[model samples]
Target: MALIITDECINCDVCEPECPNSAITQGEEIYEIAPDRCTECVGHYDEPQCVAVCPVDCIPKDPDHVEDEEQLMVKYDKLQAE
Candidate 1:
């Protein structure tokens, strides 16, 4: 599943750079995750880097964007393709 930043986000900017897919971005107030670009770090790491670094644990899985591991891997490859 794609991860989402909740309203609990502090906008501290800590989780933005930790995302391997560059899926996280600064929003008007809280940070937002681009679901289309988010692969949950499937091809880059064992776990989601943004969730690992977030101090408030505001990142949570988006139930609306659920996807399988194979789908995530394919998204990751597409993101890194040149």
Candidate 2:
């Protein structure tokens, strides 16, 4: 599934560069994750880099964009093709 940055985010800027897919960006008040581009690092790493490095632990799977591991892989493959 894609990941989402909750309101708890501290705008620490640690996550944006960590996204292999470039799915994270800075919003007006906090960081945001692009659901279409997010694959939870399925094609890049075993774990999501942002989550691994986040100081506030505010990154979490997007329940609204729910997807299984296979789905995440598919998204990753599509991203690679692009």
TM-score of each: 0.96, 0.97
lDDT of 2 by residue, 29-63 (tens): 99999999999999889999999999999998889
Q: Write the residue-wise lDDT of candidate 1 on 1-82 in tens digits.
A: 8999999999988998998888999999889999999999999889999999999999999999999999999999899994
> Evaluated with TM-score, which candidate comes out highest?
2
Give the top-scoring candidate (lDDT): 2
Candidate 2 stretches with Cα past 4 Å from truth are none
The deviation in Å at residue 1 for candidate 1 is 1.0
Model 1, TM vs. native: 0.96
Local distance difference test, each candidate:
0.93, 0.95
